[model samples]
Target: MATFETEFLFVYGTLMSGVDNQWSLRLWRACGQPSEAKVPGRLYTLGGYPGMKDPLDGEAAWVHGQLAQLPDSPALLADLDAYEGDEFVRLRRTATLRDGRIVPVQVYMYQPEVDENQRIWSGRFTFAQ
Candidate 1:
């Protein structure tokens, strides 16, 4: 089985700072500061939010996002899980921090079918756009 040594989460969408997702802000408040990170994947728009398809298939590129440490609370984790719903499935993966450090992080990957037309070619997901 895969194990995670740190409680970090790689967020590429609404869970990011300055987004309208207040729940994410509250969760971030309970954790560490957000740090820039990169994951091998492609970001796609799912109407209101974004999802990432990892391992970068032949046509996709690396995804730009933020990595935040999660608090050591099972309740918080549960809350996050519930918030993510069935649309995404959490998994442990390695991400590259802005400082070039590699760390294991929990990434919520999209579970539903993704249309090639919704792919975010910029490799970055943001609400401001």
Candidate 2:
């Protein structure tokens, strides 16, 4: 169980498109639409939860992701927690949207103990939603 203080997130894989998802509801509440973006980091297949590291940290490559605007409030945090709350840890990160708009988005990173295998979801992404 944990908490976060932010109004945006950079969803890399499933949360993007073609991946089963129902999380966009809360993310789109703040803005009329969520932007398709890429998070500058590395994507790791950590079981069901994907792990990502920012290029700002000096990684050779940046991961691809979609930027979504979420409500910046406690209840929002709680709801987000309830959604992906347990699977990973929420962290603040800067994401470069597909449009090249830079903004801070929350990224739920998988833990170290998490395995890179056994993740059922396809890493293929799109902003179809």
Please give the CA lDDT of all the candidate structures. Answer: 0.81, 0.59
lDDT of 2 by residue, 1-129 (tens): 444455677777655533455655445554446567665555566545556544435544666656666654667556666776555777877777666777777787765553435332333333331
The TM-score, computed over Cα atoms with residue i paired to residue i, of candidate 2 is 0.63
lDDT of 1 by residue, 41-89 (tens): 8789888789888754575468898888887777777777788898788
**Per-candidate RMSD vs. true structure?**
2.3, 4.8
- Total backbone clashes of model 2? 7
Candidate 1 residues lying further than 4 Å off, grouped into runs, are: 1-4, 56-60
